[model samples]
Target: MGWMRRAKVARDDPDSTGATNTVNEHQINNEGQRSNINSLPNELLLLVFYDAIQSHDNCSAVLAVTCRRWRNIVIHEPKFWGSILLGSCHPLGKYRLWTMRIGTHSPPRRISLIIRGGPSVYIEPEWIQLFDALKARTYTIQSFHFHGNSESLSWANLRMGGFLCEEIYLHLDDRLSMNSSISAALSEPTWPTPYPPPLENSISPKILSFRQA
Candidate 1:
């Protein structure tokens, strides 16, 4: 009877040891997983978040509200705030404000205005005002392109100070209709002429070209 009891006790001991070992292994795995998750560098994490936000439009506001860390990165990302694509229904004042914000925040290296929705959608007068402001700080702008109707060129008469623009591309919908007006505007010797005054000695004229298309 005593020998049987000893054998039974030994069996129970091995079973309890096996159960304890299994529990320990599971705990170790759980701890390792947590450590791995926390090991990612902050910059890598930020990049992951940025990739999520950049894949969509109109999600910037939501991205900004995600968290303090995300907000900091999103606000400072130059690509996030560089260009403002004006929509036909966008309010003139709102467009002006957004342009100013982008100029102040990131100061884009290029300004591209696409006016191709239709001829009826004219560049607003407030856009002219924004351009005037941008011209004053023209040292930051490297290239400017206008693709749309000639009616939008009316504001080109505004004078501009010293600017080192490498290129200026003007695409006129009706070149003949706007030729005389554009020529007159360009010829103006006034201080604030229609275009940012040519960056004479700053950039080579050879670097400049005009395309009618």
Candidate 2:
């Protein structure tokens, strides 16, 4: 986070006098000029930010705090916080906050989630709420992955309610399997068609959930 705010400087200053003169000239010429990123269009910046995230070159949080405009763009864009990994060590509402931020509204976004719970995290109450929230927005989910111990597996009660997910991977201990009850409950896909930007008057931003597990 701190590094994002710092400007890079060359260590090989050929001459102290020349460097000072260059700095003075640069400041005089560009004092009122916006940085390259700031000068870019919002749409371009969004694309740049997305590329940076995909390439692991930048973090949204750091980008947001770097400048007011970037913060406004990063915070409002649901995709900026799309993918998430929640573990037993994380608090409850925090998960809820991330989900809320990755909203179900337009500029269609998909989420990839990886949740882990340990033996000590016995059936958290928020587990129900978390799944309920996901269930409600199953249409926005692209991938759902889980890894945890058997004792805590019971908390993973995600209903595929009209979920158009491309992947759903679950693992307990070392074995990979889907719960019979959840599989049996797979009903006819009943999710609403994410209306197109024009169709739903939802023409909006771009976003997708991506996380590091």
Strongest candidate by TM-score: 2
Tens digit of per-residue lDDT, candidate 2, span 1-213: 322222123224444555556566666666546575578899999998988765431266467678788889988987777555555444357556665666775443333334554544445666555666665653444554545543343344323233345444444453333433222222332221221111122222222221112
Q: Cα-based RMSD of the predictions, in order?
A: 17.1, 11.5
| lDDT, each prediction | 0.51, 0.49
Error of 1 at 178 (Å): 17
> Which 10 residues in a row give candidate 1 its minimum summed lDDT?
183-192
Candidate 2: segments with Cα more than 4 A from true spot: 1-41, 55-62, 65-67, 78-82, 88-92, 99-104, 107-117, 136-140, 150-154, 158-164, 170-213
What's the CA error at residue 179 for candidate 2, in Å?
22
Instruction: For model 2, give the 10-residue run with minimal summed lDDT.
Output: 190-199
Which predicted model would earn the best lDDT? 1
Q: Any idea how many clashes model 2 has? A: 2
Global lDDT of model 2:
0.49
